[model samples]
Target: MAEARAELQKKETELTNAILKDVSDIVDAIGYEGGYAVILRSEVVLSAKKELDITGAVIRRLNESKGKPKEAPKVKPKEKPKDKK
Candidate 1:
């Protein structure tokens, strides 16, 4: 059980890093345009000021970046054969 939990945590960290990297790219692009110096990770901070919070914007941008969800594959139904007339 401990090993399973550790593995799950490791995967979660990897996924979090990937998401943060993508969001950071968007933030960095905007920051560079606005002449901002640097952006810090929210998690590392002890607390955040309201203006510094960009969680909503990041989520919206992430959704837009990913586009619409993909359609699931269709499944064929089984058919029965007719008897000789």
Candidate 2:
């Protein structure tokens, strides 16, 4: 049971990291395209101009791109270490 729980936790963490990465990628692209100097999270900011907020734009972009294909990261196989006799 513990092993299963650990596996589930691991999977959850992977999913979270992947999701965050995708969102971060989108945010970075938006920032670059919009010529934004910086983008702040709502949780961290006490106040900001409404025009500076890009949360809605990000959400809209995500939604619009849903069902579209994304390129998978290419991973190289790890090579075995050479053994010294």
Candidate 3:
């Protein structure tokens, strides 16, 4: 159980890191294209003007890059053991 839990956690971490890296790359591109001097996360700042926020643009770009979602792989169910008397 512990081993399975650890493996799941590792996979989750890897997936999260990959997603963050992709977002960072997209944001960097947006900044370069928009001539932004600096971009800060909303969490880091107390408040910022809506006009300064490029989150919508970033999301739109991300969606465009992603295109259509791929179908997930199908998993087969395990069979129950049969007992013979």
The clash numbers for all candidates, in the given order, read: 0, 0, 0
- C-alpha RMSD values across all candidates: 6.5, 13.7, 3.7
Lowest-lDDT window of 10 residues in candidate 1? 30-39
Instruction: Show where candidate 3 strays beyond 4 Å.
Output: 71-85
lDDT per residue, candidate 1, 1-85, as tens digits?
A: 9999999999999999998899888887767865768677777889868887766777777899999889999999878787879
Supply the global lDDT for candidate 2.
Answer: 0.90
The C-alpha stretches of model 2 lying farther than 4 A from their native spots are 68-85
Q: lDDT tens digits, residues 4-74, model 2?
A: 99999999999999878878988999999999898888999998889898989888787776766789999
In Å, residue 43's CA in model 1 sits off its true spot by 10
Question: Model 1 TM-score?
Answer: 0.52
Residue range with the least summed lDDT across 10 consecutive positions in model 3: 59-68
Evaluation by lDDT, superior candidate among 1 and 3: 3
If candidate 1 were superposed on the true structure by all CA atoms, what would the RMSD be? Answer: 6.5
Model 3 Cα RMSD, Å? 3.7
lDDT of every model, 2 decimals = 0.82, 0.90, 0.93
Using TM-score, rank the candidates from best to worst: 3, 2, 1
**1-85: candidate 3 lDDT, tens digit per residue:** 9999999999999999988888999999999999999999999989889999999998888888889788999999999999988
